[model samples]
Target: MLGMSTTTGHGHGHTHDGINWAERLGHLQAIDALDRDTHADVAQRLAAGLPEGATVVDIGSGAGGMSSAFGRALAAAGGGTVVLVDAVPALLDAATAHVRAEAPAVEVVSVLADAADPALPELVPAGDLVWASGVVHHLPDQQRGVNTLARMVRPGGRLALREGGLATQCLPWDVGIGTPGLQGRLLAARESWFERMRADMPDVVRLPGGWGRALAAAGLGDVTSLGFLVDHPAPASAPARESVVNWLTFMADMAGEWLSEEDRATVARLIDPHDSAFVGNSDDVFVLSASTVHHGTRPVPPA
Candidate 1:
């Protein structure tokens, strides 16, 4: 269910793909809004080792934007095949349209495959590259996701992913370096958002055994991250700063029920509509283990 709606995604139209494409896409789009430069950064990781004419499968290829980028890349090296899979009909349709519109000769195929189904390999045509972003976290069962991803890759193929880790476990939303009296509110906000998320889309946000542990257990190779920033500094990068600001805004929303109108206003000031609070503001990294790219070969029966 890469794009299906769940409490985790605040009711976006997520599909029933084994991975939630909608939720993942929603998040990627959010990141895209600010972290635009990292587009190439991620593509390079996911596309590593892609050879001439290598077939590629994009599991949660929402709106088909990211997968399309890869598909075009494959075509550049050689006429490789691109298969876009998602349980969401809308996403599939859009992906198909994107392929036809952008890179028709690359052999783009769209399928309604759910990652959880053990039969997905049979359902999907084979490929040399397997890629997904922000996918594992949204799966109802992380272990299943690990298994499904492992199963999809052909021998010598790569399965790469970037998932949001529990970077920060409920901290003060506004306790910045210069902000005073933020510690009390930050602590309270952390408690409030945790309760709200648990009450809502607990399935999507809840991590089992942590992302790294789970990915390692899934037997993924080359797993690593940006080391999960506890709190971050506002980089000169606009997108990174925007990401931090948006996070603060979300934290405030999560704590809305527990805060007074005046306190909420303060929270908004820290992360809303404009860029005042962000000038040299110290950002809190969620300890997210950001920028994780994992690849491993799945064993196939000796033919």
Candidate 2:
């Protein structure tokens, strides 16, 4: 998905909203540091009972980390084809490289297309397993996107989409002793930015029921929703720490126009590299309060 700035009319004139490549890499690295085990476990569980040589599609495969994990799991089942789909070309490039590095045994295909585009299925083949991680919400019509994604899956195949509410997506401010509501304020800032996006982009659809209901509405059966919690108490990995630092700093930058002096001070301290209370410092532990996985299967006819 495009960064918040680009998605909300900030335009592609600037890559990553002025955030450097290191910070962007930090975000992807954070995925490995924080959710590597949880993502692998969930992918293995959901990908069970799959036939060898089956195909897998990863929608919005940012930096290809999750796609790489799925590719590795699918490779264990005698290898298969993995497709990485994303609107951004650079991301697809990174994803391709990452997937190849992680699972050389699997065939990897990269497709450049918007998740909300109706013609997506035409460009990509139907897959035995279709995975969309936080892709639907970025579309203009979430239900339409879900329906389109459902159609991309062959009968008897499974669909898994990763999404979560604010509570699950953001770390709480109370995790460290520095600022009591730093994280909470940052989340509020994110919501404020989202509101601005909604106002600016009226065509973009916002789903009320989120992923579970979207899958169900697409005629998927055996629908299930589960959540994984990543609670790193302290001494977080370098990548995870950097990711949080970048995130809080970005929020502060985005919300700078509206943030109160007190809130700004809190954000400054939270992102301060040398400050003991800084999120990315050795003393701070990065925590993903929760991460949710919603899945369902497309029904097949009886033999």
Candidate 3:
């Protein structure tokens, strides 16, 4: 969710061409490092109970980070293969390299398919474990997307997703320092865009049980939710600082549409390369956030 502003800026159909996603990806790479241990633990829990040669698929596997986590866990669970699926060709290419580097013993398959497409189930083979993170919100029809993906889960297999609204998946109003409310304004702009997207896609907001309900709607059972917190403290590392700067800069560029005149001025000052309020050189800059994952299993059909 780190580079979300670029794709859904202001949600009013305005695009920020100046946002450098490559740079955002780089920052995300660093931020993800902070959550490595948490992901590994989650992978282990998900890989448990599966036999040797289990098949795992990570839908919308950006940069192959989750793919690498699951690959390593499955490899340790007596070896298995991980298929990394995404709609972007370049992301798949990068994911291939990342998975190969992080999980050399595990086999990797890269597939390009949109998560929202109905044909998504046909393009990929059935698997023992299917995981989708930070992608469901982009789908036009959340229920159809969930059911379509669930169909690819072999009977008795499990389906897991990391899903949440934009407001719950953002940096705090005060990220320890910098312009006191700069991050808040940026998040407001992002939320405005997300609200618009949600309005267009009613299915997203209509999920009564959130991810768990989506799982049940897909005919899955034993659904459960797991929570994880990402807290990056002050005196942030070099990479963290770089990530924070890149994210704020990009958000500031696209905030004009949703942010008020005063808020826009705040964003401009905070993002100005030479200004004292600039986030890049601010000593108090940091990030603290959290997210949740919903896990469910597909019950074996009656004989």
Candidate 4:
């Protein structure tokens, strides 16, 4: 699960709820770096059918790693504009620099706005392709969020949302420490914690059906979904190992209260570098995950 952290101000990483945005940024950067190739592939797939010099908008754009990848793809497709929108000015600044440095030919525009804001469509330009990764789920009114994104898609253009997939799996079912199936238990706790998080959100509204259906409900056409695999086999790279550890640490921390005392201790031991059970110390550690993207296109008006 992606950590939920709010970016309410500059240099102030904590929201009123006490979630640390800076720490979350570090984790996001690590994951982005580790999954660079996979992200690039996804970008290429999204960019392939775009018209030349198309305008692409990235909603809830984090450190701009994915936006940079999109810039690279756009550059390959003969240059375009990428509008990076996020609530955090710092993140937008970082993303602007990253996009410019990585895809200098592509124009970069940063919009400081929250994804949940009703005025988002007015603040941001209509996009030839709009992308929101791990964003819509955080909104209290998910359908309204999708509807707002849909409004930004120019006719005949597409809106791509990266949401829902199997959780990342790093360690084996039995880690040979604490209890067997530690990861399984952690996942269960995470589900409970997720429900609580949603309930805690202001004005939370529940919607049924998967993202594809949601897109259709939002008046988009030809909705389709695809899954991308992120697999790092045995003898994982140092970055992959680092990512795995960070991911587990974030999960453990977020769902700690729901986790059993033994499970919490097991997690601490696994992430502790000084401990022999540290995941980083193991040569067998690997990162495996699958992310899904739902695509829906704005219908062209009949002649």
Candidate 5:
């Protein structure tokens, strides 16, 4: 939920490892430029599964990017609360602003905290649906967070989670910070992060499978996942072309200690081209996601 650079615990101390406001904004802009109605399409489906009014806990809600979308959906469905939590303060700030600007009618509360912290259970009570996106990759401890998240959702509460995952490795064109290579830097920097995740994160099950397993472990039911890969190529003539530099900053950051300055600069060059396609011309890649949408009931009756 913080900026991309904000890792949960595995600190790289790499100069490239920190929040880049500009790049984050550009990412959102790319979302805006979507050929398909990215958020709206996803939201329509996500909201349909929800009750008219319900409280939600959005984990790893970076700058409230997806939180704003969730909030907007709930607002449209007779109103509800979206509690956006991210450890990063600046991301929370931006998410707050985005929610207000985008979904003013929805009740949005931004909390600064970690998903794996025990204190989280108290902050978000059981039965509140938990929504998360783009927060899992940065987490050093996935099982713990997934377990806690499952418990936070109250009886009959639904949990919809999505994270950046690698179903297929990107081709040369798509293999950059904004693509599969982003995970590469994180893996290179936090060797332990990936190792532990691989042993646990659920067979590259992007959304629902691994997440579903965690939910079932926490006593959840009715789980499902969905996935597809789309390349968001920034056109050379886009207004915010400079945004590309900011966009690739974190990818650069993770690789800072590993890649030479020259290769790193090449990364910038590739991303800056603006027209570069992230979905390379090959069958060996897909931005595969196993989006898990599950429901859970409190095992015990209300005390």
Candidate 6:
């Protein structure tokens, strides 16, 4: 699941268009751990057929999990550079260290700059592959951000944007403790909350025609959209269980107000580790999430 920026009274903390790294480091780290394998798979597919020393850029790289995954893939492709860009300095530092430690064979660079910055291309060099996962939605002007990223892809190189897909579904539809359709209600509330969050963003601009058209409008060719699934069946791993707990806690905190009192109480009990009905402790608890990546290539000039 992607990190979202919103103002909330939730103790977890928040930042404008980014996670509050100092306060929510544990939450971010847990998510990275849960998504590590899926991220590596995406990296492998994206890194295929690249030249020996390809340059890959990861925009809005958080905790460097995806960036490091890209680094490892690049290393396997011979050798290359993985540039990590983010607005948060701490995240940038963490990602830099993580990439270096995880993919020592590949060169790593970090740039602390907002994705919406018009001058971003001046700071980061063109990339063989530009990757931005769960990032464009944070910008006030999404298409402008996509255009900026497109500018960073060298001719013939690709730009991949990981955006919409089905939200994670961990608890069963009938989780005995809550109402029969607690998960459905929660998803509804989350959607409403998300709409409000986007509207509240400063200078927010509506993105018409979705990401695929956005990529095409950016002057990229051969646009493609693909989805990657992260599925952990019943008896989920410790990290997956923990990630589910964290996610529920976040939703309960951030969207609790929109939920009915009964639903809110149910969520509270579900996330409480000590509760006998805690969802994470259930043998039936599972994890399922799908992330869609939109790809476009900067067309090579005709001979």
Which number leads on TM-score?
A: 4
- Model 2 stretches astray by more than 4 angstroms: 1-26, 165-179, 274-277
Q: Give one digit per residue, the lDDT tens place, for model 3 in 29-133.
A: 665575687778878888889868888989877677778889889767767778887766566667777877877777777777677767777777678999998
Q: Which candidate wins on lDDT?
A: 4
Which regions of candidate 4 are displaced past 4 Å? 1-18
Q: What is the TM-score of each candidate against the true structure?
A: 0.62, 0.84, 0.82, 0.93, 0.65, 0.91
Estimate the lDDT of model 1: 0.58
lDDT of 1 by residue, 1-303 (tens): 212211111113454322344444444455544433345446555666776777778776667766767766765666677778776666666666766565655777777766555677777766777877666555656677777776777776667666654443323444554445654665577676654544455354345565556656766555544322223333334555555555565556546667766667666666645646442254443322245455555554568
Model 4 residue 216 lDDT score: 97
Residue 85 error, candidate 2, Å: 0.4
If the candidates were sorted by their TM-score against the true structure, best first, what order would they fall in?
4, 6, 2, 3, 5, 1
lDDT of every predicted structure (CA atoms): 0.58, 0.72, 0.70, 0.84, 0.54, 0.83
Better model by lDDT, 3 or 5? Answer: 3
What does candidate 6's lDDT look like per residue over 1-303, in tens digits? Answer: 011111111122234543355555677778888888888999999889787799999988888889989988987878888888877666776778888888888877777777888888888878999999888987888999999999999999999999999998988888887578887888899888878888888888999988999999999999998889999898888878888888888888768889999999988888899998887777888889898999999999889
lDDT of 5: 0.54
**Worst window of 10 by summed lDDT in candidate 1:** 2-11
Question: Which has the better TM-score: candidate 1, or candidate 3?
Answer: 3
lDDT of 2 by residue, 1-303 (tens): 111111111112122222343335546656665677877887787788887788889987878878888888988888888888876666767778878888888888877776766888888878999999876765667788889999999999988888774353345547555457656666677777766755565476667866778899999999998777766555566766776676676677666656778778767877787776666655545556676888899999788
The deviation in Å at residue 81 for candidate 6 is 0.4
**Higher-TM-score candidate among 2 and 6?**
6
Better of 1 and 6 by lDDT: 6
